[model samples]
Target: MSLELKDVEKKVGIDTHIHSTNLKLEKNTINILLGSTLAGKTTLMQIMAGLDKPTTGEIWFNGENVTGKEVQKRNCSMVYQQFINYPNFTVFENIASPLKITGVKSDEIKERVGKVAELLKLSAMLNKKPDELSGGQQQRTALARALVKDSDLILLDEPLANLDFKLREELREELPKLFEDRDCIVVYATTEPQDALMIGGNTATLLEGKVIQYGKTLDVYNKPENLTSARVFSDPPMNIAEINKNGETFKINNNNVQWKSNLKIKDGKYKIGIRPHNITTYKEGNNSVEINGKVLISELSGSESLIHFTNGKLNWVSLSNGIQSKNIGEETKLYMNIDEFLYFDQNNRLVNHG
Candidate 1:
């Protein structure tokens, strides 16, 4: 009912792919591995599924050590970013292949496949081949195959990465509900911050080969344990600026911009983080700071405006609610609510406001 990785480390010819990762996941929970490319998400998932052996630690499942266990001996399933399906076989056959491999009775195989296909909305398409199915349908077929096995551990390595935006959105919204009643531990890996938020599960933020922070999805997003976790959990990567804090106010380093901080802290240097959505083209709150910037780029994404600009020596991005455009090099002013700023100490640890 539980999977644990204890002091796990994976090194390939001196290049450490997974560094000292220790994590435990319980059944009926979805865990997200949130990181960018080459951030060791895949390598970690491989280790968990027994596809790759950890170089230095033990893997325990249900209190038994299984570090060196062959993947075939474990009851686990993996779905990749690619919609891998047997083109020559029908959707029902593809879903039942795993059970068929274990020599399940014909009646049980039919029942299991039918139930999983129905849950995945593939019942009507059971007679069709993979080549005839839509991209989303093919992916769902692959997922149905995994679910039909009744796996104790499910590892999804960015299963929706290759689908269209609409299909991806649809699947993301349905994923949590699909796992609501399952008794397995689901670990999903993704590079997009938005995907992790919509999944609404526990998350482990990865950077390079190290896990920076792990906690409940919303708790980790709202209160990142450190600056690295905050940046990894943000879509455009959270904006950072160094500042010098005096008794009552903090001044942006190497700039004339200054603002009052009600935080009680020692007089020293620190870094402040600003999420893109906290900045607006107009004043939004009574206590706000104004920053004048030279526009670098303006991206209109549907109903939102993502503006990248430079203030003093630092580059910042502002995400406004509506259609707001500015030409490159044009001077613009954005207002940021003072309370939304995340204060980090010199050591990169987030400082809580008192």
Candidate 2:
């Protein structure tokens, strides 16, 4: 089975919510829509789920056109960022409601719901109302509802966004394992780049209303097709700076920092993209370049020290491993590895360094 979007576009009057998009997702594979808020992840997923119709192009499901089909007529399940559970019903009732609507046998509903609840670790709470369950339990109930339906397509729209950090991490690790044996097309949408990476699937990075890049999650993360995709995939916002390359060396514009480079690109002006984790307070290797900046903000997250600093006019962030404290307005030096730089042409397309 496959879900294909052919030139699908969604526009409300003159404003476009989803730019023309085309993607084909095969069965039994997890696909992630990775983008920030207002990046059209929801709009695109709605079109795929038949909750919204595309203004242009067709949506094909297993070779049959399903563009205009009502969501109720399709065998698809959706879990939202919100809990979205029936507060009045017990966990079992909430999970069994979909089966009841489809006229499944009572005994079979009991069997199916029982199994799904156990898998989601909700078996002990089958009789508890939604009001009595914790946030994570409520969300899991919603997910269990979706899972028991045996949908041909499952769309999870930032399903873990509202959960606590511990719960989110727990579920994120369990999600892939939950769907490992399911024979359905799983589509998960999230703004967190870390979520997409941990999910381990093909990812389509969205920017504004357009899909910037779509490929294997790590491949797209490691080799983003353009600057927009790179920025979208980065959590702390990737650092960018304009530079001029003359032969084997490039100099940062507006700064005296010059580095000898081996990038196999044309010698001209280009924007260089650097991930925050690559910029650390300490040097990593023999080729690490040192550049000093004034610390604008410094905070610790767990074992990492997030140092936000300003070098000239550019605001850069360094996510250094371990605890390194610094006060604001303090002078701090950052080390950047030149080999990890991503070069982008004038049009923002990534220039291959190979």
Candidate 3:
């Protein structure tokens, strides 16, 4: 049930598309492929699923060479963004179609369909046609169909895109449970960072048709390899600002910003990154990078509030819980967590200070 793509390269004539992409996936765990639009998330999944062929590489599954194999020959099922259920078919028939295609007996098909239906909570909608069911239900039916096939690999391409926010949230929590105890590997592709966090397993960050980083979920988030990968998972995105070294201290906006490092710097230029949640606002502080600014906007979301502050040409955001303020036009001072700052050299590469 394990899948591996070794030196997989896909090209389109003179254009070299995916360049030497290598990935190793273990059995029975969710591997989320995260990227923005047109990042080749779908292309990589398609190659592994046998729907598309790699230009100059091989696909190995369970120690067998399955390259150039037809889609049906590969023991993989995919649930795409578009619900591929038949409008004329009932939910039960749609879920049972794969089983029937493989020549499963009528009684066994019913048994497998029933189990999958209950797992997806589509037992009550089995008799309803695809047209009669809601969007979420149709998606569940599509997933149930894949489950009934007992495929060794499951490929999901933004399967929750069509569902409403609440439904998407519920399914996000439920979908992972369906893979438990199964001998299959699930490759879920998503453009949303929240989905990757909620799924919580091995993750690969794909950028421009290449997987730049792949490791445990938290490790990738905590220590992103470069600026591009760092901004991928950040909400408001990492705030990057230029810094100038003044003797041993780094100065930002002509103010000495304290850095928890003793490394010597003959810097031409350096950039510092800080996440929004890592910043805290204070009225007055002794060792803080204080700046005066007017509140641009305050967004309240019941439990927490996100306040955006602007000081001249510089903009920053702060997070607070249960704190209310009306200072859109008033002056305010802000403080940043210097200890949580990340530094990058002129090449835009992370400079680790140990």
Model 1 bad stretches (over 4 Å): none
TM-score of candidate 3 on Cα atoms, chains taken together:
0.89
Candidate 2 lDDT tens digits, 1-354: 999999999999999998899899999999999998999999998999999999999999999999999999999999999999988999999999999999999999999999999999999999999989999999999999999999999999999999999999999999999999999999999999999989998999998889988889988988888898999999899999999999998999999988997777888899999899989999876788888989999999989999999988889999999999999899988899876888899999988643
The per-candidate count of clashes, in order, stands at 0, 0, 0
TM-score of each: 0.97, 0.98, 0.89
lDDT of 1 by residue, 248-326 (tens): 8889999988899778888999999989988889887787998998999999987999999998789889999989989
Which model, 1 or 2, shows the larger TM-score? 2
RMSD (Cα, Å) for all candidates, in order, is 1.3, 1.1, 3.0
Model 3: per-residue lDDT, tens digit, 1-354?
579899998887887667789899999889999888888899899899988899988999888889978998878899989888978889999998887888999999899899989889999999999989888989999999888888899999999988899899999999888888798999999998889989988889988888878888877777777777777767765677787655657766544444434446665468778777666565322334555657888787656767787765567777655675746876766677565667777777877542
Clashes of 2: 0
Clash pairs of candidate 1?
none
Q: Which stretches of candidate 3 lie over 4 Å from their true place?
A: 13-17, 245-248, 253-269, 282-292, 322-330
Per-residue error for 102 in candidate 2, Å, reads 0.9
Scanning candidate 2 in windows of ten residues, the lowest lDDT window is 345-354
Clash pairs for candidate 2 = none
- Please report the candidate that would top TM-score against the real structure: 2
